[model samples]
Structure formats: C-alpha cells, structure tokens
Target: MYKYLFLLGSSLAVAQPAMAEDGEITVTATGLAQPVEHTGQAVTVITRDEIERVQGADVTRVIQRLPGTTFTRTGPMGSLTLLGVRGAPAGQTLVLIDGVRANDPANANAEFDLSQLNTATIDSIELLRGPNSVVWGSQAMGGVMNIVTRIENGYSASVEYGGDDRVTASAAAGMTNEKLEAALSAGFVDAGGYSSAASGTEKDGYRQYNLAGRARYHVTETLSLTANARYTHGKVDLDGYPPPNYTFADADVTEKLRAWSGRVGALYDVGILKLNAGFSISDTERVGDDPSYPYSIDGRSERAELFGRVALPGQLALDFGGDYEWSRFSNAPDAGKAHNGSVHALLGYYGDRLIVTAGMRYDDHSDFGGEWTFGANGAYEIAPGWRLRAAYGEGFKAPTLYQLLSQYGNPDLLPERSKGYEVGVSHGERGDPVYLSLTAYRRDSKNLIDFFSCWSGTAPLCATRPSGFYYNVGKGRAQGIEAEVGLQWAPGLSSQFAYSYTDTENRTPGDVYRGADFARRPAHMVSASLDWESTMGLALGFDVRVVGDAFDDRANATKLDSYALGDIRASYRVNDMIELFGRVENVWDQDYAIAAGYGTQGRAAYFGVRLRK
Candidate 1:
C-alpha cells in the first residue's frame, strides 16, 4: 500500500506546475553563504514562515519533512526522542545551534535528545545530508542539522492549550540601532502526558522552561562582535517494569535535566581577507530519583576556534582554521577529562559553469592519538536549468567520556570511522516555482562500538563472566536513494514531497549480530505536505507520513509494523497583529509504535493564538 502511495506522490509531483519561492541563503553546506542550488550537497531549509504555517508542537515535526531522516520516540509529547539520518545511528548525526555543537558529552553515545528542543525562537533550520566531517569535525558521519535563532528587531507572543491538558506560552522582543542589535525570548510548556508503558492506566506528566538571548555590536566598520546564549530546564515523570505481583501502574520515579550553552565571537573583514574567532561552552546536569535511590551526573565542554578566509585571483579562495576543545564528566566515584585540538584547510573555486571544493583536516586526541580526514565536492551546470553534483568524504566519531570512563567503560576502544560518496542530479533554477532532485549514495563504517560479554579468565563460557563491557568489534554498511520535489502551484499554494529507500546490514565478521539489519531503521519512508492561503487571511495545510516495518532490537526479534499518519491544520488572521490557529494530529487515530513496548498518542487536537508587531 505504501509503495502505491509513493508512486502516486511521485506522479503528482512531476505533473504539478511551478508556484514560487522567496530567496533564502544557506551556510551549512560549505561554511559559506550561498544559494542552495549552487551547492554540491543536498540541503533543506525551513524558514520562519513555514514554522508558523505548520505550528508543530516541537522541532522534531519540522525535521520529519526532510529526506533521509527518521525518528523514534518512546511515547507521546515530552518523551525520549532519537533522530537517525541515512540509516546511521542517532549518535552519528551532528546537531548545531548557530554553528556551536550541542550533543551531550556525558551520554554514552554523545547523542542529543530532540524532545528537549523547542521551536518558538528558531528563525531558520538547515539540514545538510550525507557525511560532512570536512567542515564539522566530529559526529558528522551521518549529516548536520543547524538551527539559527531569530535576531531581527520585532515583538511577538503566542499561547496555546489542547490535548492531555497541555499548555504552552512564549514571547520575544528585539531592538536594533546603528551600532547594536539585541533580542530576548522565553517559553514554557506543561503537559499531562500518557503512559509510557504499552499498557498502563497511570499518567506521566512533563514540564519545561527555556530562555535565549542574542546580541551583536559593530565595534568598527570593518569588525563586529556577537554573543548568544540558551538555557533549558525540564522534568519528566517515568515508568518502570511491572512488579512480579502487581498490575501495570505508574512508577514512583522521575528525571530532571538542566542544560545551557553560550558563545562569543568576533568577525573582521578586510578587502582581501576575512578572519573569525570564537569561544563557546556547554554544561549539562541530570538527576534521576526513586524512593530508594537518587543520583546525578554533570558534563561540560569548552572550545575555542580561529579561522581565516582569503580571496585570491581567478575565482579561487583559501580557508584555514584551528580549534581546541576540553571536555569533562563528573559523578560520585567517577570523573574524567580529555582535550583535543585540530587544524583544517579548504580550497574552493567558483566559475560560471562549475563549482568545486576540496578540504582536509587533522585531529589530535589526548587519550587515543591522531587521525586525518579529507573530502572533495563538485557541481557542474549542464544547461540553464540542469545540474550534476558529486561528493566524497570521510568521517570519524571519537569515544564519548561515559563510554571510556564509566563502570563498564573500555579504555582501549578505538574511534569509529567511515567513508562515503554520492552522485546526484538536480533540475530547476534558484527561486523557481518547481525544483526536483534525486541522489544515490553508500557508506561503509569500521570499528563501530558495542557492549559485549567478557569473562574474568581466558576460558570460554566461564560461569563468572561479567555482564558486558564496551568493545570496538562492529562494522556496517548503508546504501540508499533519496528523491525530493518542491512546487509553488499558485499564489499562496505550495507543496513538497520526499522519499528515502535505505538498505543497511551488519558486516562484523564472526560476530553474533552479523548480517542482521540495523535496529530501528526503516527501509522505506515518505513525507508529503500541501499548504494554501487565501487573500482573506485564511490558511489551510495537510501532511502525510509513511514508515515501513523495522526491528526494535539488534537481534531482530521484536518487529514494528509499518504505519501511515496524517495531520490537518488551519489558521485565520483577525488583523495585522493577531491570528488564531488550530490543528488535529493523527486524524485517523492509527494504532502504531515507533518502538516496541512503548505507547503512542491517539487522535489529538490543539488551538492557539498569536500576536506580532
């Protein structure tokens, strides 16, 4: 059934007429500002207008529309959410806020929890698909997702209430002058969430608060200074396994987290050279409690970087940079610190008919050693509205602090490494009403990390064998095809369609998990949306998502069936400064689960209002 739907969507996408697009600039693909059509890599940009039109509860919903991306959540709103790209593990995907890394250093896999992120203050989002380690040092084996916050001068506020007794409110204000510009924003969310267990009557609730601020000062005509900071605090009710003699009910357990990140930077521009330097820090603390036990952990990271770009003759440019990072993890009876430094160089060429870039990086880790990585990308314009692009890159993921210093940590574990390449074709010019693209790529990874059982002695099957310990004993391969189509059908009417087909397999020789499919990765996924607005201040939108069957465990013993979901939303503008909106999610109330033993939300509705100036 999904195959048929995918075919139908493809046909309609090809048959539809072009609409129109506002010109937008993206900087994630090449570390430089440029139009999406000019970059050699696949990129997706979601603007503020799109965010307001869809009005998703969280940032994950906005990301679901991109190609080669998938998400798994334990339950409804405020649940643990993980994101995967191109069949890569969640930890392999790098996340950034205004060019600053945001992954947790204390996590065993150094992965970010997407559920904790709110979209109220985001100005734009840029998703760059495929390996990007040449520009982003670590955790770029899969791709990069960069969130840019709002900085323009304006004032806005919103409030909403809906299903599960959920309440949300947010406000922002900004001002600008000849020498300085500043903005501040804050938001709050509370929800009486559903049970986390597959079958339970007790409800688990959630609460969160967030604050963010940004400012830029023009010290001189040729130099500027900027600073930004964000903080989030959240608490979530938890559920545990059923008791031996008790029925399914809520467990007396909870978890709390507080995290903050900030960065300060300066940019200096001369006629022939541009220089940039920055310093940033991120700190996170988490606490888990039950009647009998309570524990906490802390993680922190600090980094400094300097980079320069020089303009040369003949449409050529050179870029060079270096950075230093310090990471630390602390807890009772466990503490560790590590330092890393890296240098990189890139060369680029821009011409009327071709664009080319090549880069290399060398990294030195205090504990392990040193490694080198390189990449190249090229795009050629075949005609006025047609182009061909190809890219090849290498990526690496260092062992996280928790994986190397905790009780089950392995001090000798090696870093996971990968090599990948892609070739694609694109049609339609920038700002055109219709654009289409298709790409095919493959990646091979080695030294993947996993926990395995180990015995005290050299004997096999020893009775005193330890439960498990981390090891570098895994390998895998992923190959996939991606397709995307965008159309501006008419004035106030627009649509988008995206599809991904991925095939992944374990390649670890002589390992028990060899030949098994990567866990929680669907082989087929599709997303499509259509939106329309009327001159009378009325807007309507519809979206559909389809996910194929997948296994919940590495052994492939627990299977999750395929499912399709749909959503509908509408909005009416009362005046230039006021608007009302509402939405219905899972309109058909389809029974599905992204993870085994987890409960998903049913049909739910929400209503809200907004004021802007």
Candidate 2:
C-alpha cells in the first residue's frame, strides 16, 4: 500500500520561440533570440515539415528522435504522457505554449500534461537540453521545451481515420498583413479505444478537443502588441481496483480535464536594444471519479514578465528580466495561495570565433523565503565548421501550492535544487552531408521532494497529521553520454541516428531505494530514421525506436522489458493546395507497454488528406 502512495502520474507544458537555418540557428527560449552555437547550449529543433515527415498524429513521435530524451504513456493515444530530459523528472522539465507558462498549478507535482497536446496547429518545437536557470528560473532543472503555433496568412486542415474507430480532424485559418495579423485553429479526436488494464475485457474510450488563437498588431515602427490564447478539454476512461476484490483491475472510472492559457504582450526593437513585456494567465480544472474515491482540482495562475536586451561596445551585450506570479488552487475543502518573483541579469561577449556568457538570478518565494541561482556557458570554433561548447547551471523548483496547502501539505518544505554540467564537441552544421556530435554530462539533485508517510515515523510532523505529508528527503545523481549522427545519401535521401546511455542512482541516505536506478529511466535508448523525397511530389519515410530495460517502480522490484518498434509514413501531393498522407504504426504488431499493466496499440494504420493554401 505504501508503494502505491509514491509520487506518480505525468503531464507536460511550457514553451518559447525558435528559428533555425543551416548554421547558427536562433534559440528564443531565453526571451532573447540567440544563435545556438553562440549560446553554448545543446538544442534540437523540429519543424512542421519534419513533423509531417515522421510518423505522427502527435509531437512525441519526432521528439523521441533526440538524445537524452525519454517518455512514457499509461495507455494508448490521449493517455497521461510524460517527458524527461536526461534523467530529470517531468516536473523538472518546464514546457511553454506560445510564450505562456502552462504547468498545471493544481497538480501535486506541478507538472504540465502533454497528453492533450497535438501537432495539428504547431509550427515548430525547440528542446533546450539541460538547464539555463538564468532565464527559465524555477522548474528549469532538466530542460525546456518551446512550442510555436502556426500564425501566418494561410489555411490548412486534415482529417484521418484509423483502427478502433479512431477519428481525428483539425483546421487552421489566419491572416497576416502590414498592420495586423491574427489566426485561429481547432482540432478534435474521438476514439473507441481498447482496454487500459492488461487484464480487462471492456474497452476504455477517449474524446478530446482543443482551440488556439494568436494576434499581433504593429502600433509603431519599433513597437508591436501581441496576444495569444489556448484551450483544451478531454475525457478518458481509466481502471482502478474494485472494492470487493481490492485488486488491480478494471473498474468504473473516468477523468475529465479543462485547461487554458492566455497572454498579452508588447515588443519593442531598435536594432541594438530589444524589449518584451507580457501578462499571462493559466487555469486548469480536473475531475476524476472512481468507485472507491473521487477527487477534483481547480487552479488558476497569473504572471507579469518583462525582459530586455541592450547591446554594448565591442560585440558585448547585457540582458535582464524579471517576473512575478500569483497562483491559487483548491482541492475541495482545502485551498492555498502562492506568490513568487524573480530577477536575473546576464552579460555576454560575442567574438568572431569565441562566445561566452554568465548570469545570476535571485528568487523570492512567499512560502520559502528566497534562493539564488547562477549559470555560465561558452562556445569556441576550433575550425571553420566545428565547435567546442560547455555549460554549467544551477536550478531550483519551489514547492507547489498543493504541496504546501493540501491536507497532507507540509509548511516547512524546502525547494528542490540541482546543479548540472556538460561539455561536448561537434562537427558540421545542420543539413550538411555528415553531421556528428557527442556530449557527456552530469547532474546532481538534492532536497528532492517526495511523500513522507506517518507509518514510517520518519518525521516529527507525523505526531500531528498521522497519514503523510510532502517533504524534501530525496537526492540523486545522473550522468550520461549522448551522441547523434546524420548522413545525407542522395539529394532527397537522408538518414539519422541517435543514442543515449544514462546511469542514475538514488543517493538519499538511509533509504531503501538508495543506490537503485531511478524509476522509469532506462540505461540506453536508440532511434534511427530514413527519409526520401522525389521531385515528383512523392515522399516516403521509415523509423525505428528502441528503449532498453528499466524499472517501473522505485524499489526496482518490477523490471520493464526492452522493446523496439518501427513505422512507415508516406505522402503524395495531389496539387499545390491538397495532399494525401498515411502511415502504418507498430509494424509487426509488437505488443508492449511503457507503463506496467497497460495495454499498447497493435499494428495500426491511418490515412488522411491535407488541404493548404
């Protein structure tokens, strides 16, 4: 019973902007767009075209092709999907949706749910691997994901049907002009999904819908106003232990979610000086009902942010920013409020062949007082097309409101903290005939938060509360090597491969799980893909993904077996404004599960048509 009480469940959120070219791609996650090479950071960008080239119905398909990336889903599509960079947990990897912070304020772990995110209206995804606490501040322990939505002058739509009576449809339309630009998009999904429990006999269905809008108006030559909003709603069937048997099995259970984010901002740019200011709001509501227990979460958050960049003499620049947020949440009879504010500054030198940067941050939390963070990174071009880079960052995540105000909340909990270091060398640029890079990195995290049980009699607080409360008694270390290679065969043909080797150890003293591998973190992961496009408006692609063995539980008692899966996708252009697409997933009908006791999809196929103008 105690094992079941561990922190469990997953979701994803957060975003920034990014633009890429063959070399010196721009990374906008820092609030200021900087060249990836000059920023001394390891980043991977997935464009809309790349998303279509890969087997998809979602963004996860393309996200897994990068090193130091791992994810898991409890069931089939629309399930609770979680992501991790290197060996960090889901909550440590912040996600941004169109410049808005989307992490769920009501979640016990304060993580964003990625299950509801689809690529239907997405234009690009940028993953900044490793911490850059100087800009991201809290929840930047692992990495950051920046997602940009389509907001150009155009119209696009797609519809598809697959196995198990699955149907997906999406449409987007927008306008762009000299003075003002605006766009909106919507998507829907309905599926007669299979059972979630491996031993269940009945089907568990799922239905979801989402909407997004973005607008920008040029008020002056050097000033612009921007606004964006996103909304998602979903319902899914789940399984639970029944009363009579009290065993892990199927039961009458369902979960419903309603979440949204909105932001209004202004931008000012005059070549040497740039400024960005914004105010945003995020809200989430969730309901779960089981025969045994029922629970609901209501949360809302608001934030105001401002950041600016000023160029100095001799290829030098100074960047500074600050943000304040207020969050409130309710879990039935219990309610809580939290406030946080942070300020940061950075100085950088952009020489012709060498770039260096350093920064520091100070955060004030109403619940836990204050903390400080520091970061530095540099990159040097050893040759014309090769470079050496390294980075160091310190990060901390404040306790969620739920962790401090709920029934089991602990008022004296400390913020979780981590330190990360990485260095690597690379050859060639993106799209080159041959591209290769490898990095070895390490991270140490302490004061990690976890549930402490009264039954264990570990803390004096058990004297008053009895059951359990959130506490900071966890610690660990993770180190790894990540490598990727890409090769271009013919003009329209290319292949890419990526691999990761991670070693994790739970280092909390006097704990049973100490020295054990981190739950859900595998030792190795590999991905390979091949793509071909002809001048005749035809394209074909195939990919294989492999995940090594891991443990599904902290005790490492349950072993998760290794699995490899393959997929094939093809698209044919019918005209300039229309196209036909289809894909076969889980070729060979490989039956496997990312979460123990969960059922996975068998060999399935989906066909669709796309219209664009």
Per TM-score, the best of the predicted structures is 2
RMSD of each: 8.8, 5.8
**C-alpha lDDT values of all predictions:** 0.80, 0.82
- Whole-model lDDT, model 2: 0.82
Clashing residue pair totals per candidate (backbone < 3 A): 1, 11
User: What lDDT does candidate 1 reach at residue 411?
Assistant: 75
Global lDDT of model 1: 0.80
- Poorest lDDT segment (10 consecutive residues) of candidate 1: 11-20
- Return the lDDT, model 1, position 332: 54
- For model 1, the superposed segments whose C-alpha errors exceed 4 Å read 1-23, 245-249, 428-432, 455-467
Alpha carbon lDDT at 49, candidate 2: 75
List model 2 lDDT by residue over 311-419, tens digit each: 9999999998777788999888789998888888989998999999899998888999989999998889999879898999887888889888888899999989999
Stretches of model 2 off by over 4 angstroms after superposition = 1-29
